[model samples]
Target: MTTDRADDRNVAVVTPWYPNPQQEWAGAFVQAMVEATAPGCDEVTVYHNEAWLMRQAPEEVEAAREAHRRLLPVALHDAPTVAGARLMRLPVPTVPDYTFAELAQQHASWLRESLGGEPIPARVVHAHVGLRGGWTALENARPDARVFVTEHASFIDKVLEQPDSRDMYEQVLDRCTGFFAVTDVLRDRLAETFPALAHKIELISNPISFEAPRPRPVTELRRWLYVGTLVERKGVGWLLEAFAECHAGDPELTLTIAGPGVLAGALAKRAAELHVDHVVTFTGEVAPDEATRLMREHDLLVHPARWETFGVSIIEAVAAGMPVLVTRCGGPERTLAGIEDAVGEMIDVEENSESIVAGYHRLRDRFPDGLDLAKGRRVLDERFGYRTVAQAHYRHWFSGPEAGEGAASGGEEA
Candidate 1:
């Protein structure tokens, strides 16, 4: 972290979510951003601040905190740096159910403790979420460092509704050098939430890397894939019902549910209840690379999430050269705006499977001729490809020296 390095090439990423042994699917886009932006920079370090909540009784909380304070030093001594960046895993032990503002304070305090009360030794710091990550960066970043935050949490509405959390978020918005949202839906939500700070927010899409040509183009839409957490919010139940209906007509049709969540067993039982368990496969959580491979093997990606701030999986599927049948959740509508007909179908979000079944039929009728997978892939690549996203980040972070130095006074135009 020497100043002799190229200007604005030394960057630090502070994030509450990251791929770890406990949750491999968490904060994958944050890792992608680090990997994509790291190549162009001289150095990148990621400080992953994760909470290790204690389930002990109220009377034992103090003892647990003391034990954690003693054990953390030994734990961090042999921590490994993974992937393309120098990773520092900062695990904070605490009780669960704290409000967002209180939780952010704990996260920031842990980061400062890890650094021995010293400021983060980087010129630019980018955090994944506003509350804990952005607030952590703002608290620890050097006086001259340019700090930025990207809002990507699906539970952001809950976080902002609380008075304490909203006040803390406003402070974070006021202090950071710049802020970005992954999609127009998220940007609009943030803008409307704080109209005075609306001008400071902008768009920065998640990056995707295109793979080699598929061995063969999809001639038929038989194999369906869903790659995400198996949660109620993801509409996994609706997806399962729709799959059963589709499979009844076409016995050859199959569905694969990837990723892990609390609803795995319930979804499995529901599949059996629908009598489609034999045709469905549940492969629990997978590494990011394996998720990509799954996309390559399947003909279509079916993401039936009730909502999304930014649907990274939908873009990843398209990059893998697979068409998608996703819900018109907030993200997919904006991400697939003009290319709806070219990619696949965009059905409305619903509790029942009727929309999904009808959309599947409509997409099936279009088949190979009516759809243009290549055009969809090209369009998304130009927008979300690694090169495109990394450059956009650099332009905002290092376009001028004034931007880096004016953190307290509000930096140069983004």
Candidate 2:
């Protein structure tokens, strides 16, 4: 299952977020994108830039450096094989003296140096997010190389919040050979923010790595699920209030919040104060299989992110034929675009508590009744499945050097 062509499709994928033993689901989507790319190329090598001390606990930081001072590169070449790709994990020791761009350059150069100081002669360097990885790829790009950047990071939401950040981000974006956005709305937002590159910004949805699992029957007690890090922007507190609203009317309702984060204890305590703690369960970060099982068993998924570029979890839920209630906080609204009939209504973040409560009630009313979750899944596959996303990347990968660019979608449906 290897390519017959000479290794022309060789690509170097560099990213800040990548799955490691310590962080299993940190950049699972980026890995899925790489896997989707595997079959087409001669060989795809991934360089995960894990900046040490950059985000580590203070105590763990000193201990980690003492233990792994060598910081050597290792080949983790198999197991989760992607037809034609090789996995290389490099653990980097962070130097606080470097700025984001400087650190990123060091990361990319280190990878290039690892290959015996040979300038990587890959077709392109694809960086998963815009933060530093995208800028790094641009800086390290060979004179003739094509550099593709995908800005699916939610930081863009925050970037837009501040004047200086927006300028700094766009300065990095200007260097990309091409830019990919996770949703059409996001593409539009990027274009609106930086009209100069609007034509080059293209719509590229996040790929769903898993197939639709066989869904379970709707439980008699009506199980509700929420899968993601429980953080402030996730609107877990708002969800607790809304959940209590629903439960006050129907004692049979149960809400299970999965995934762990800084907000877990607080959310649980809030749930207790709301008197729904008896019914609410907080199961800290389960494995993927357990997550899929939970998605299958539950009838509804409540996702109320204050901001999101795109919600891959919604795609997973739709695959399991589970209904979801989301907020139009950002990009998740795009998930509802073509599948509104099946997905029903999405809540407006500006809405009051009663309105949020009402949206949940509305989603429950439509669940399993007239809702064909499979129809939503069909729409998801057509738009966000691996094949669709990979093909989009393939086109970008092979685009002639003269194709030039604008911040744009390739005029394809997002």
RMSD values, in order shown: 3.6, 5.3
Worst 10 residues of 2 by lDDT: 405-414
Cα lDDT listed for each candidate: 0.86, 0.73
Question: Please, what is the TM-score per model?
Answer: 0.94, 0.83
lDDT of 1 by residue, 129-231 (tens): 8989999999999988889999888898999899999999989988999999998888888889999999999999888877555777887899999999988
Segments of candidate 2 deviating more than 4 angstroms: 1-5, 54-70, 73-84, 95-106, 109-116, 157-168, 217-221, 401-414
Report the error of model 1 at residue 121, Å: 0.3
Worst 10 residues of 1 by lDDT: 405-414
**Tens digits of per-residue lDDT for model 2, 1-414:** 332223346788878877666766678788788877777665787777677655567677767655554444343232343556766666566656555545555566655555555655675788877656776666666666678888787766655666555665687678788889898767888889999878888888888855756545554326889998888888877887888988999999999998879999988888888998999999987765577788888878888888887888887887776778888877777777867657555888853567678887676666656566667778888888888888888777755533322211331221
Task: Kindly report which residue stretches of model 1 are placed more than 4 angstroms away from their true locations once superposed.
Answer: 1-7, 77-83, 403-414
